[model samples]
Target: MSPKLDRIGSVHLTMRQVARATQNFSPSMKLGEGGFGTVYKAQLQDGQMVAIKRASKENFDSLRSEFRSEIELLAKIEHRNLVKLLGYVDKGNERLIITEYVPNGTLREHLDGIHGNYLDFSQRLEISIDIAHGLTYLHSYAGNARFCSAFGKCSNGEAMDLVDPQMREDVDEKIFKKMLNLSFQCAAPTRADRPEMQAVGEQLWAIRMKYLQLGREE
Candidate 1:
């Protein structure tokens, strides 16, 4: 095992094992595609369901360094909203990342009505708060430099505009504004001006609670 994999205590799987589990990357097993590569659903010998991300042959060499760095980073961070990295495979030209299977699907999929499930206003608020909490954990525990990329994305000051159209109507404007304000703070030009993740999480939780209380009174 490589030092990075050793540090993370990640399980190392052989190419044959991965191929067997994925039925040699059968089309039906393919889950999704991303910048990293293709994702597939696999069932391990022990009956554990996992999502495997395989790097494209064209990008394999170029992404090796990034893949290792990501493994090292993910191994050290643990959060409810963040997917857990279960293992990895690096053999010849093959590079793969294994993670726990999330059966419910992506938040975008739910919002887009892919699974016949639509989130209500309260549910959407809860999800927003969850994201804030996760971000808070990443910022506070992992150090600012480690999360600079994420911070940069929020720097454009268009955070509120990214809200889903389906969630626009029937929103608690008061709470929504509070969440928006928090986003701006997190995206502050100066890192010192940004509130610690703990504070961000607390504020988000408070907004969620306030919204829930108002719901109870109505």
Candidate 2:
């Protein structure tokens, strides 16, 4: 069964039980905490390092559903740009997902930093392609809700939003047309406008390749 269904069917457990059974976590191994849960830097008894994400306890079911969706979706896809899901420990209300530890930190952190090592146009193009490929895989194979899962998902999302807070910035003619179609197909008051993941991925791949090839010239 899918992780989402499994989580829903699970019986609730206390925090201590959750913590005790979680592998690789040490007292000093914390990374960060969010609405989702606390992330810790863990090293397996075999010396393999991983990022362990513990889901936060919440009264709301949507957040839990989102958590389950993320874990379920990520497990089925892999790409160079996407964070890898190594394994997971799921027992009732307490759940933990092991993932590759990206020490470079979140894209949001680096993008927002004052460092001169910012991504240039060419670099952005390449990174965009990478991100597009990752998203394409998710949409095509992971059965995500398309635009809901693609936008503002990483540092680029925040950067893009910050640069064009209103999303009114001008784009190329071809890109503009494609974006319009995406809006018509995926952005709707009703969920019916959402397209199949395969179609969404293809569209993203086409646009991303167009941008990436433009970078090759520079």
Candidate 3:
């Protein structure tokens, strides 16, 4: 909700309007399907591009209960890296969360060379910092981070095995090693052993500055 809509502020959209924009939920408009439901990309009549996340039909009641909070919490997020909530449709059992569309494919896609050119080491490093910043903001705003401790599953594997194959040409072993160490520290098995997100963001920035300094020296 928009916050202005009902305390949720999300605009109440009619199923007819959504159907019209989505070509009656045509398969062609589908961007992806996930555990919740399908996501569709559409251009609204006002020329606004948006991603619509429709709830799964199979588990209507439970899914509705689940996504209700998702809609509310997501609407509170205003960071650039995070998607912006626009409006929603709650008519009948048709539940949808509409958000501003980001044209760039997922980070995984760029890593795999699926949507963009392969990411160089510098690009990958900057992207990692961006992720850390996003996490910092999320942790600060949400306040309750029960899942932050779950990041311990990541691994450095063997020394060379952890590096992205695409970044072999420009990867800096020292900087990469520091990043891997920080990641491992974050994923420490015990919650008490993990660094705070704010601290993580700081270390990422410091590493990024060193990377740039080395670039200047080179």
Candidate 4:
């Protein structure tokens, strides 16, 4: 159960009312909705556009859990590629998490699209590396013990939310090699086989540095 918000003076809002009261709304503002909730593009008072995720009241426990997880996790870490969690609201069944808007779109789009401007091999490698590094930090980056059980898992292989599988095929050989290795390390059948996120980040960094040197020489 979500802990009640002591403030807000018990503002009871229907789904429709809540939608209208949001910072902004339009067809273009719509990012995407998942099983949990719909995401909207809202411009803050400071004129910063943010993606606000509005969680549905149904599946109360699941939504509450996700809200709690996102808040707790995003609070500690900060990175370029990693999505930023701006803030959250929980008052009388109205739960929402405000996050930074990523205009570049998902890595998936760059991976598969007619847009002449796609993430080059290096960019693709960097994005994947960045994601791996972020996950690594999340897994081992200790936070308040109150939120123990650090149960975040990498959902990479599963159907990607942002891109298609066909695009993944055209990735350069070297990029594929590194990604395969990282995925394998993360999903090692034996828990012991999985390397810590910190270790993985260090390894990826080392590999990237070496690759850069090779390019410089050639």
How many residue-pair clashes does candidate 3 contain? 9
Strongest candidate by TM-score: 1
RMSD of 4: 18.0
Candidate 1: regions farther than 4 A off = 1-10, 139-218
Candidate 2 vs 3: which has more TM-score: 3
Candidate 2 lDDT by residue in tens digits, 1-218: 11332332222223453354344355577878866688887654455566777777663355555666566666666577777776665656656776778877666665766444776788778878888988777665654344545444422433233234466644455554566567557755446667877889888898889877766765
When sorted by lDDT, best at the front, the candidate numbers are: 1, 3, 2, 4
Candidate 1 C-alpha lDDT tens digits along 1-218 = 32344334455678888998999999999989998899999988888789999998889879877777667676777789877787887777888888888988878898988899788999999999999999887766555445554445445654445567887466665676677678778867578998999999999899989999989987
For all candidates, what are the clash counts?
A: 0, 0, 9, 1
Worst 10-residue lDDT window for candidate 4 reads 145-154
Residue 39 alpha-carbon offset, candidate 4, angstroms? 1.8
| Top model number, lDDT | 1
Off by over 4 Å in 4: 1-25, 65-70, 142-218
Q: What's the distance in Å from true for residue 184, model 3?
A: 29
- Candidate 3 per-residue C-alpha lDDT over 127-168 given as tens digits, one digit per residue, 9 for 90 to 100: 899889988888766543333332222332345555678874
Better of 1 and 2 by lDDT: 1
Superposition TM-score, candidate 1 onto the true structure: 0.60
What's every prediction's RMSD, in angstroms? 17.1, 16.9, 18.0, 18.0
TM-scores for all candidates: the values are 0.60, 0.47, 0.57, 0.51
Give per-residue lDDT, candidate 4, residue 72.
57
* Global lDDT of model 4: 0.60
